[model samples]
Target: MTPLLTYLAKVVIVSGILYGYYYLALRNNRFHQWNRYYLLFCAILSLIVPLLRIPLQFAPEETSNSYTGQVLLLREQVFTPAAAAEAGRTDWAFVLYSLVALLCVARVAWGYWKILRLIRHSRLEFIRPYWLVLSDKIGAPFSFFRYIFWNSDSRFETPEYRKIFRHEMVHVQERHSNDKLFMEAVTALCWVNPFFHLMKAELALIHEFIADKKAVAGGDVAEYAQSILQMALQSRHDFQLTNNFSHHPIKRRILMLTASRRLRFSYLRRLLILPLAAIIFCSLAFVVQEQQVETRAAQTAPADTIKPPPPPAPPRPNAKPAKPVFDSGGNEVFTFVEIPPSFPGGEAELAKYLSTNIRYPKEAVDKNLSGTVFVSFIVSAKGKIDSVRTVGTKKGGGLEEEAIRVVKEMPDWRPGKQNGRQVAVMFNLPIRFTLAKPEKKGPDGVYTRPEKMPSYTGGEGELHQHLRSNIRYPKEALDKRVNGTVLVSFVVMPDGSLKDVKPAGDKVLGSGLEEEAVRIVNIMPAWEPGREKGEAIATRMVLPIRFSFQ
Candidate 1:
């Protein structure tokens, strides 16, 4: 699911739970005095957990695929009997099922642990007049019990204290402890729902409002405020389960209590109906998402069914040169061809440049534009860049414009050359707009570019002779069982020399192939390196050396 949708779903689920809590609380009284913010915070955390969990679910499988695709294939092969013993075992589906099961177990265990801790800390305290109260020593209600009255050394005869006591009494008489336990349990279970915490907070607030109204209906508000302040000052942490007469934030409680309005039963009834509607809608949305995912998977099955093409054949060491080649053949072939390199720079440089030059077209930034744009074109024979196109990953006009504009301003390249002349070659580049780590700076504050190397000017016949004499293929590659290409990039220096031999492409062809190609290239008979403006400077080049069995 998209991040936006993921967030929305979390919000809705949490909200529903809160609304449910509020509805139930209202059933007891119209003006209850409680701290709603506390509950809201709890629900918010719960919501975030589940949303974050969704992405992590696929992490193990993705890592496995990246680290060892062969292992995954092997698992699929060896476990066929057991897999066949079960039903429905598509790779992705199996992975998803495992993820879901893991998440469920983790979430349940975490939630149970949290609630258990809360219950333990809220040791039940039996007090006077056959009343029970749960307190965390912060004057907040830990559970339902009789009205608790303890603040200062001196017992106050204030009307506010009386009202507060009455509020606690209401909680005790109505078994508010049980209701709270239920609410917390639900909130814990739905921790991934941001709205859950919000709803819980709302419920607590409404509950407070109801109790406050009942207390103030017959007396003075000023006295109640004074009593709350006094109790708060003298509150002790020793109380655990006893319901406290003095709860804070006292100001919020007072405001809620004073605003409490006697509403008709019909109003609450209407609210109940709305929650039912919301629940149904959310359920439907979830179901639709599931169906869409299944449909997409079905559509993708055919595409994946197209087995990977057999790896390309390795170039023969002593074979005749292929005709119809772009560059010259025997006596004119180059051991190395150089292509100019370009970089937008390290993170800091990019940030600095963007800060000063990136105008982000206010509209695009306002709309929060983000995407990866793939720009592919050719570097001309003379190293000039052209045909820059922006293919958007998401539908954002401004983002495309910014990307295209930036690409157009890129510095000219020292075009790719082959044999003794330049040649146009296709290049693919990906530009991404994302929050990433800053580039690291070395001690001396120097940014080093890859060193340039010389190019070769020799015939294909000479190239073959050199390769046959020096190349040493890995045992595996020579075994004719591995069919893969090794793309190597090395420098051919000014005076018929090879330096900085390296692999410039995929490693799937096997690291062995790459090393063999590099070794052969390094020892090959050198060619005259390409020159620029009568000066022979080091050049950069890429070469694809392939190995195959058939």
Candidate 2:
């Protein structure tokens, strides 16, 4: 699954457990303050736990192909084919998710705007530590942060008015607006998650329960309950960031107020949160174990396995003497040769020639395919290219055909040298196909040189630590002895979000190794965005991760 989907799943699981615990054990208990704090803490914890990765260390396994002489060249090339008339596909799921989230944010913003306008138009009066706003437009009393809005029609001299004021005071003094604001932001981001909305409603009810308990202390509890019932019948605007006196169900508030406090020992039931948190941590830190048995079996295989017979000798008696040749498995065999092979001129000339002659296939262009293709061939003793074939271009789509055709068309190269004579030698060449284009500019604008370069939360060392802890080596790669470095490139947006993650070069080690590298990169937390001239800007970055069994 993608990282976003995985995070959403974790949120659902954690929220479900917390909500279930609240409903069964703590709903009717008299620990209203404890319940209020628990909901806020759990909500924040659910978002954080998914990002905590725990590293697991194991002894390195031995492998046969541990030679380090073979050089691996990493080449990155971008291709943008001439714009074709292909129909564009719409990402409906992303569109729907973004639209819903925007609507939720707008709804929250509108509520805040209404509250601010009410404060602006109403008469402000000082009531002890609280600033009271007398608004004739407001139908019910509510408290937001340090400001309390009172219905202008209510008589301040009455006993009922005094009781309502006490309830609003509890909300302000305890900072209930902080909890509401946090939950409101959560709801806006995850509007599609019905659980968040349900949690929000439950938290509002908890706030009311806490305020009701404080309001009735050392006073007539029965009379206070009657005032709550009367206020519930009045019209009220349900602002998300405010604590409204009569917003919660009237019966639940009155019942909670009158219920006997649970035994102090029963409060230990809250300890259930500890075990629930542990389960969540373990689930998020899941790791895949390497297949030791298969690795052992491979290590024990016989070295003297059946091998192919030697190639037949040349028919001409006067032909040049044969020289040693290495098979694909690196095993030595005799072949007609003399000198080792070399490209005409030198390595520099070979690169220049390939770049000058290679053509991007029209078929590949139409499909927007771009990558490197590795071509392997034999440089004959006569300095002629023959037996030309492609080693890997697993991204087929006519790319392999184009690479092979270019190799066959090359002029004769310098003959190989073996035992002071010309000989045939194997040669591997990688040709890249790219459509020339300019660097991409992000929505907020791209930065070529930034005052502060983007980095992981801690530093580059922490990024490596994160990758080492989270990357899961593919089992197929281990069994086949496929190991190499995979280069991944991504764009860090101005808002510190990652986008356009992809492999920077052709896949060197197949068997899902490259895919695993890309997955790990995608799951990384956003970096500190780069800044240019004191403003955040998008910057592209490339990272290489190596996979090895030994």
Candidate 3:
């Protein structure tokens, strides 16, 4: 999976586990406040646990293919959307994700707009530590940040009114609106995640339960239940980003309010499962390391069964390496080791990277100079390149400079290692600079279209068959599992001779892929020329040559 997809998958997994455990352990608990925080905690864990990483150190590989005289290519390539589209890339999944996310955002914005407009039209009734918006537009009571939206015509007695006022006041004081907003943001971001939506619904219901419990404190619970039923029978309304009195199921609210004996320390059950869940989650998040004793035994003995472990050897005066063991950056390095540094995809990818990225200097091409320049650098223990320089018999005409420039553009490589430990190693690369022979254009003018279009000797199928038969995947790219289609454009002259063959787009897929495509096109049999006014004419044509291993 792509990195983004992987991250989302992790989030989904974490949320599923936590949510499943909660439903089984604490879902029906009467401890509304504890349940509320725990649910929020689960949301936080689901969102953030995937981002945490625990680095585990281990012995390095016994055979690293790092600096085996290879250039490495980074998987990263920057392309503008125009360039990507030109290369025939269209990510429909990304489009869908963006569209859904935009809708969620618009929904949230609309909710805020409705709240603001209601507050603008309604008259404010000042209540100590909070305020109320009395509006006939609202059919039910709901609490926002510090403002409560109440029906101008309420059908409750003085005692019931006080109890209901306390309910909204509880939401305002405890800042449950912020929790709803946070829940909104999560659901919006992970709209496809059923657990997030479930969590949003669960959180809102929990908020109601919390308000009910606080509102009925030292008051008649039966009367409050009666008042809820009275409000239910009246015309109702609902809105988002607000604590609506009638938004949740009426029966569940009354039962939770009347239920006695809070689930005492239900968190204990959750805590018991946490360590086990954490252990499993951590195993996936953390890196596995090499065994310490096994590494030592592997370096010394042929068989682990026969050896008891050797004692430390005596220190020598020349214990330090004769050559510099550390680079200017203060990291330990090596001239040679069990494993040499390499590119991410190894030698083949290295070759592809160099061929694709290294461009011959304009000055050198103009002066018709070609040579091989030797470039050297350090591949650090962590696969970083440093200390880049060039050395060779051939130097001038900007050849050495260009070689150095491209080498410096390189990212980190697979670092060299010795005795199962990572160490930096020296890297050397030889880059060849050569210019292609410029093709001479025919005297006949190229035409976009004529009275008659050009035709292959046989048909389009035969032309494709010829390309498939003759074109070979570039060896360097093939070794590294590289594949792409090259769009080659050329002209069929009046006499049916092909000329000016080249890739047709701004995208340059190097590593000999384009060269192979061009080679196949140039060697094709001549086509029957286009015509205009009973006379043969040259016509431009574009052909797509695909190189797919599968």
Query: What is the TM-score (0 to 1) of candidate 3?
Result: 0.57
- Which candidate ranks first by lDDT, i.e. highest? 3
| Least accurate 10 contiguous residues by lDDT in model 3 | 295-304
- Can you rank all candidates by TM-score, best first? 3, 2, 1
Worst 10 residues of 2 by lDDT: 294-303
RMSD of each: 23.5, 21.4, 17.2
lDDT of 2 at 386: 75
Q: Scored by CA lDDT, what does every candidate get? A: 0.43, 0.66, 0.67
lDDT of 3 by residue, 92-210 (tens): 77678878988998999899898999899999988776888998788768899999988788755688887887888889999999999999988888887789888889889999888
Using all chains and alpha carbons, the TM-scores for the candidates as numbered come to 0.31, 0.53, 0.57
- What digit string (tens of lDDT, one per residue) describes model 2 on residues 1-550? 4346767887887777777877787767778788888888778877787766543323232212221111122122222343212112344766787798899889889999988998999999997777999977877899999999988888989888888888999999999898898899998998766677887888899899988888888898899998888788866656768999987688989998888865565757888778877887787765433211110011110011011112222234553432445544443322222223445544444555555555567888778777767676776667777777876537667888877887789888766544555655555455555554533353456553355667677653356356545666565654455556566677778888888888766556688867886788789897788777788888776665555432
lDDT of 1 by residue, 1-550 (tens): 4334455565665556555555564433433333343344334443453343211011111111110011000000011112222322344744564575567556645755654454456444456563332433324332344334332332237555456656766666666554455556555554455555555455554555556666677677777666667766766433322334554456777665565466567455435545654554454333211100000010010000001123334545765433321322112221123322222222223333333333344554456554445454545554455666654255474655665665566555444344335555444444444322222222433211112223234433344334434444465544444544454655545675767788764355664666666766676666566455565544444444444322
Backbone clash count for every predicted candidate, in the order shown = 45, 13, 8
Which regions of candidate 1 fall more than 4 Å away from where they truly are? Answer: 1-129, 132-143, 146-160, 233-244, 260-550
lDDT of 2: 0.66
